[model samples]
Target chain A: MKRVIFGSSWLPYAFLAPQILIVIIFFYLPAAEAVRASFYLENPFGGGSTFVGIDNYKDVLTDDNYVRVAKFTFWFSLLVTFFSLAIALLLAVKADTVLRGAKSYRILLMWVYAIAPPVAGLIGVLMFDQHVGPITDVAALFGYKMQIGVNYNDTAAAMIIISIWKQVPVNFIFFLSGLQSIPKAVREAAQIDCRSSWRRFWTVTFPMLAPTGFFLLIINITYALFDTFAVIDVVMKNEPGSNPMTLVYKVYLDGFRGSDLGGSSAQSVILMALVLLLTIFQFRMIERRVHYT
Target chain B: MMETTSSNLEVEARAGGRRTPLLSQRRFWRSVGDHTVLWLGVLFMLAPVLLAFLTSTHDAVTIHRDGLQFLPGDHFGETYEAVLFGATGFTGKATGLVMTFNSMVLGIGFAVGKIVISMMAAYAIVYFRIPFATLAFWVIFTTLLLPLEVRILPSYEIVQKMGLLNSYTGLILPLIASATGTFFFRQFFKSVPDELLEAARIDGAGPFKFFVDILVPMSKTMIAAIFIIMFVFGWNQYLWPTLITTDEGYYTLVRGIKQIIQVWVGANIPEYGQAMALAILAMLPPILVVVVFQRWFIKGLTESDK
Candidate 1:
C-alpha cells in the first residue's frame, strides 16, 4: 500500500520463502488434512482411510456425550467471560478512582497475567486440595464439605474459578485502559447534567465502554473455549467421571485416548468452523467499534 | 472531572466557611475506601500463589497430614533442592531443572523464530513490490482461525510423518509461524514514514541493508514487546507439546509439573511439596518478564489489537 517499493521480485520471494514454506507445511497442510480426514474413517494404526461420506460427522453430531460437552462448553465460556470481565471492570473502576499508589495497585494486579493457565491450575489444586488446601479447611469451618475429588459440580466450579483468576489480569488491563481512554471532560459534563454518580456512570461511562466490553466479550469466550485446556486437564486428572469435558478437551480425548480418528477429526472440523465464525465476527463486527475513536 | 469537582467543593467551602471539615472528612473516607478495596483485590488475586509458595516450603508428609500451613516452613531449601535437582521417586528421568531448561529453550526458540520470520515476511510485504502479496498476507492471517487445538489430529500426523516427534525442531517450528506476530510487524512497518525509505534508496542502500541498518534498529521496542508475549505464550503451551513429545527428555516444565502429579498412583503421597515448588519455578520467568517489561507488555496487548 505504500508508494515506496523495491523492484527486485526475486529478493521479495527470497524474503518470503521461509515463512511461506513453514505456513504451508505446518498450518495449511495440516488444516487441509484435517478437513479431508473429517470425511473418512481412518484406521488408528495407519492401515488406510476409507471415505465414509459424512458418516463421521453424523456420528459426532448425534452423540449424546458430544452434545453434553458442547452444552458444558457454552456455559463455561459464558461464566468465565462474564465474571472475569465484571470483576476486572469493577477493579479498574476502583483503581481509576484512586489518586495514590495507583501504579502499585496496577502492578500487583497485573502479575497474574503472566502466570500460565497450567500453572494457575496447579495453584488452584494447591488452594483447593481436598486434604491440605486452605479453601477446603475454610469450608470445613462453615460445616460444608468442599469435595472437588468426588463432586462433579465442585470440579466444574474449581475449573471455572481458576479460569477466571487467570483471565482477570488481561481483562483488568484492557478495562483499565478503556476506562482511562474516556475523556475527563465527558465525565464532567455528565456529572454536571446528572446529580447522582450512579446515573452518570450508567448514562455516560458504561455506554462509552461498550466497545471495549464487546471486544473483551469475544476475546474472553475464545480464551475460555481453547486456552483453558490445561486448567480442565489438571482439575479433572484424578476424577473418575467424564462430566467436565469441554469441547476441545473432548477432541483430545476422543482422538488420542479413545483412538477415534474420524470422529475426533469431525469434531475438530466443527470446532474449526466455530472458530472461523468467531474470527469473522470479531473482525467484521467488533473491529468497526474498535476503530470508531 | 476530579479537578473540577474538587475545585468547586473548595470554592463552596470558602464561601460557607464551615464545610471544610466535612470536605476533608469525605476525602479521607474515600481514600480509605479506595485502599481497602484495592488491597482486597490484590489479596484475591495473589492469595493462591502465596499459599502455593507456603506449601512448597513444607515437607510432603506434613502438608498431607496437617491440612494447610499458614506460615512458612523450614523445608524450603530441601524441598526446592530435591524438586529442582532430583528426579521423582517413581520415574528416574530428568529433574525439574532439566524440564525448566527445555522450557527455556522452547520459549526462546519460539519467540526468536516467530520474530525473525514474521519480520522478514512483513518487510517483504511492506517494502517491496511482490506478486500475490496481499493474498499471501491473507493466507497467513487465516491461520489465526485454526489454532492448534482445532487441528490437533492432522497436525500430529504431519509431525509424525516428518519424523519430528520428540525433537526440538518439532516442538518449535510448527508453532512458530504465528499470524499475530506477522500482522503486528506488518502494521508497525506500514507506519514507518515513506520518506525514510526514499532517503535510504537515494543513499544507494539495498533493501536488505536498509532493513538491517535502519528498520530492525527502529523496531527494537516492538521486538521486545512481541518477544515477551511470544516467549510467555511458548512457555505456556500445553496441548501441542503434550502431543508432540513422547519422550521424557523433551518434557517441558508445564507438562512435567502435570506428570509429577499424574505419575504418582496408588499409595504414594503424590509429592505435593515438590510439585508446588516446580509450579512456582515454572511461574518465575514469565512473572519476572512481566514485572520487568511491564510497559512493553501492556503496549503489546493494546497495540497489537489495533
Candidate 2:
C-alpha cells in the first residue's frame, strides 16, 4: 500500500490538473448547471429560479411538439446513416477496384467535406431558393417547378441532400481504407473461383468493412442528431413548418426563444441520456460483430 | 484419362472466352466505366460550387437576364472590385473587414493556444504519471461526449459573465482546451520509447529539454496535421461566433459572407456578383490548408486508425 501510494502520490494529480480544470470549467460545471436549471422554473430574462422537480421533464415529454421532434430526430438519423453508409460503401468498392485517379478523387471529396456545414446550408439556400436561384432555373430545364428554400419540407430535403453530399467523401475515405487494408489475394482467389463481383463484395468486401462501418454509424448518427440540427435551425429560423424539427432544435427553441430553461435542460438531459445509452449499446452489441483484422 | 484431360482443357478455354480485343475489350470497358462514374460523381459535387462561382462572376442584373449561365464574363473584375471595396452605393455596413479580422483572430488564437496547451498537458500526462490521472482524464474526455451545441446557452451566459462577449477571447477560449487535441497528443507521446528519455536524462536533459529535443522533433508531422485540422475546424465555426458576436466588426468571414447573401437576396438582388466573389475568397484559405496538408492528412487518418 505504501509503495503503491508513493508511486501514485503526486504525479497523476499534478499532470491531470490542466485537463481537469478545463473539463470542470467548460463541461462538467455547465452540465451540472443545466441539470439544476432543468428542475427550476425561471424566466431567462432575469430573476431567481424556483425548484420544481420533474415538472419540466414531464411537460416536455408530454408535449406533442416534443414527441414530433423526437420522431423526426430518430427518422433523420436512421435514413442519413443508412443512405450515407450504403453510398459510401458502393463508392469505396468502385474506387478501390478502378484505381485510376483514385487519389485525386479522394482528395476532392475531403475538400468538400472540409467545407462548413452552415456554408453548405447557405449554398443550398442560394441554389434552390425560388425567386431567381440557379437551381430553380436548372430545374426548369427539366420542366419541374420546385420551390426549395421557401418550403420547410423542401428545405429539410435540401439539408439532407447536402448532408449526404458532404458526408459521402469522408465516409468513402474510411471505407476505402478499410477495403484497401484487406489483402488483395483473398479477392483474387475469390474472383478466380468464378464468384461474381456482387457476390464477392457481399461475401468479402462487406465483411471487411464492418469495423469502419460501425464507427461511422455511431459517429454519423451522433452528428446527424446533434450537429446538423444547428444548421437546420439556422436554415429554418422562424419558418412555418410541421417539418418535424429534431429534439436538439426543440431544445434550442425552448431554451433560447421560449426562455423555459428548465424544460430545455430536461430535453437536453434526455438527449444526452439517449446518446449515452445508444453508444453503450452499440459498443456492447456491435463491437463483437466488428471484424478488427 | 485423355478424354477427361481434353474436357478439362476445353472447360478452361471456354471460361477464358474469346480473345481480348485489340485494346483489350474487358480492360477498355472497365476503364470507361471507372472514368464515367468518377466524372459523374465529380460533376455532382462540383456543380453547385461551379454554379455559385459563375453567378458570382456575373453582375446581378445579367444573372436574371442570362438565368443560370456558367460562362465567365467581364463582370468578374467589376464584382471582385465591389466585393473587396464594397458596392459603390449600397446601404448597410460593409462586413468584409470585420469578417476577415474576426476569422483571423479566432483561427490563430484557437489553433496556437490549442496546440501549445494540449502539447504541455499531453506531455505531463504521459511522462509525469500524475495522481488521479485516469479519473482526471475521464473527466476531461467526458466533455467530448457533449456537443458544443448541447451546453451552448450556459456557455453563452458564462462568456457574458466573463465579459468575453464580442471579444476574441470568447471565440478563442472555448476552443483552446479540446479533448480531441489532448487525446491525440497523449496517444503520440505514449508511443515514444522510454530508453530515449533515459539516455536524455543521462545527458543531463531535464523534462523541458527532453520534450523540446525529442518529442516535438519526432512529432512534427502529427503537429502539422493537427494544426491543419484544428485551423479548419476553427475557421469553419459559425453558430457560437454568430451568437456571441453582435457587432459588425466581429463578424467572421462565414457570417459576413452569409449576411451578404441574405441582404442581397432580400433587398438588391444585383449585388450577388460581389457576394459570390467574397464567398469564393472566404473559401480559399481553408481549401489551401487542405491542399497543402493533403499528404499528411491522409497519413494521419490512416495511422490513427490503429
Candidate 3:
C-alpha cells in the first residue's frame, strides 16, 4: 500500500501520458516535419525528398504572384479586423446600455458565427454566384454592373467580406464581455462630471476595452491568414488569383494536381516564413499593449 | 451616501414624469443615434440567416422574378423536397441519414477524445508536482499559435503512414487533442483548492479517487465549456476531413454539403432557393445547441476572461 502511494508520484505523467503522446504524434512531430520538408524538395508519394536548400524560400519571395498574394492577405486581414471590430463595438455599446432583448439578439449573432466557416463559405457562394447574388442586385440598383461572385476576379474582396462576416460574432462577444467588465460606477461618475457620451466612451469605455480588442486582432489575423484557404477552396475551387494561397494548397495542387512535390515543398516553406514572421511580431510587439487589468 | 442619493434622484428624474434641460434632450438624441446604429448592426449580423430563410421559402421562379426578399412565396416545401430528393436537377444522392451519422461519429468521437485527454492532462498538471510540468504546459499551449492548415502536410503524411485514411479514426484522429482545451482546463484546475485534496488524502483516498470524487465535480463548468467548444469545433471541421477522406461514404455533413453545392454551382447556374434551403438545414443542429446551452456558453467566456 505504501509502495503504491509513493509510486503514484508518476500519476501526473500517467494522466498526462495520452495527451502528450497525441500532441507529439499529431502537432509537434508534424510541425517539425513541415519545417524540414520546407527545406527539401519532397516527393513522399513517389519515394523521398531531395535537398533544395533555400530555393523554395527564394521562389516564394521573387515570384510576382506570391508578392501580390502577400500584399492582398495583409490588406484583407487589416480591413476585416477594422470593419468587424468597429461594427461589433457599436453593437456591444448598444447591447450593454439600451437594447431590449439583448440576450436573444446575442444568441442570434452567436448562431451565425458558430455556423462552420465552410457552410458560411457555401452561403457566400450561393449569394454571390454572379447571376444569383442579392448583393449584386443591390449593386445593380445603384446602376453599377458589379458582380458578387466567388471567382478569381473578385476573390480578394470576397475573402475580406467572408472573413468579416464570420468574425463579427466573435468580435461582438469579446466587446460585450469587455463592456460588462467595466464598472457601472465609472460611467455614472463620468455622467456626474458632465462628460458627453462620446467623451466618456473615448476616455473611459474605449480604454477598458483595449485588451479585448488586442486579443481579437491577433486571433482574427491568424485565423484570416491560415483557416480561410479551405473555405476558399470549397467555394472558389481552383480560382486563379486567390490571395495568400498557402503552401498547403500550393502543395496540394503541386503534388496531387501537378505531381510536382518539389515545387510544393518550396512553396510550403515560403508560407511558413510569412506566417512565422507575423506571429513573432504579434507576440513581440502587439502583446505588450494588452492591458491585463 | 450623497452619491447614492444623487444617483437615485437621477434615476427618478429619468423615470418619473418631469421635464429636464436641453442638455438632457441632447443626450436623448444621442441615445437615439446609438439605438439606430445598434439596430443596424443587429440587422447586418442577422441578414445572412434571414436571407437564407427567406430564399428557401421561395421557388427559383420567384427569385428569378422578384429578387431576394423576406416576403414568403409559397414554395418552402417544394424547395426542401427538391433539395432533399435532387429535384432541382442536380446529380448524386440527396444528403440524408448516412451523412448525418458520419458527421455525428466524427464530431462526438473527436470531442470526447479531446475533452478526456485535456481533463486528464489538466488534472495531472495541477495535482502532481512533476518535473518539466511548466515546460510541458507552455510547449503544448504554444502549439495553438500554429493553425491546423499550417501543419496539414505532415498531418496528411502521418495519416497516410498509419493507414487511417478514409476510416472514422482518420477523420477524427488529427483533431482529437486541442491545445486550447489544455489551456482552459489547466487554468480551471489551478483554481481548485489544495485543502480539498488534502482532506481526501488524510481519509486514505488515492489520487484516482480524489480526482474522480473531488476535482472533476469542482470543474464541471470548465468541462462544460471545453466540451461545447470541442464539440462545435469537431462538428464544424471541413478541410482536414476533406483532405483525409476522399471517399463519399466517410464525408461529414460539411464536406457533403460542399460536394453537393459544388455540383450545383458547376451546372449552368445554381438553384439559389434550393441551395439556401440546404444551407439552412445544415445550420439547424448547431443553432439548437446554441439556444439550449447559451447560459453555459456565455458564462464560460466570461469566466475565462480572468
Where does candidate 3 stray beyond 4 Å? A1-7, A43-45, A148-153, A241-256, A270-292, B1-17, B21-24, B61-69, B81-91, B302-306
lDDT tens readout by residue for model 2, B152-190: 778778778889898888877775544878878888877
Clashes of 1: 0
Better of 2 and 3 by lDDT: 2
Which candidate number has the best DockQ?
1
Query: In order, what DockQ does each candidate have?
Result: 0.64, 0.39, 0.44
Tell me model 2's lDDT, rounded to 2 decimals: 0.70
Of candidate 3 chain B, the 10-residue stretch with the lowest lDDT total is B87-96
Interface RMSD of 2: 5.9
Q: After superposition, which runs of candidate 2 have C-alpha atoms over 4 Å from their true positions?
A: A1-16, A138-144, A237-244, A285-291, B1-19, B87-94, B261-265, B268-270, B302-306
- lDDT measured at residue A186 in model 2 versus the true structure, 0 to 100: 78
**What lDDT score is found at residue B293 in candidate 3?**
84
Cα lDDT of all candidates, in order?
0.85, 0.70, 0.69
Q: What is the TM-score of chain B alone in each candidate?
A: 0.91, 0.87, 0.85
- After superposition on all CA atoms, what RMSD does each candidate show versus the true structure? 3.7, 6.7, 5.1
Clashes of each: 0, 8, 0
DockQ of 2: 0.39
Ranking by lDDT: 1, 2, 3
TM-score order of candidates, top first: 1, 2, 3
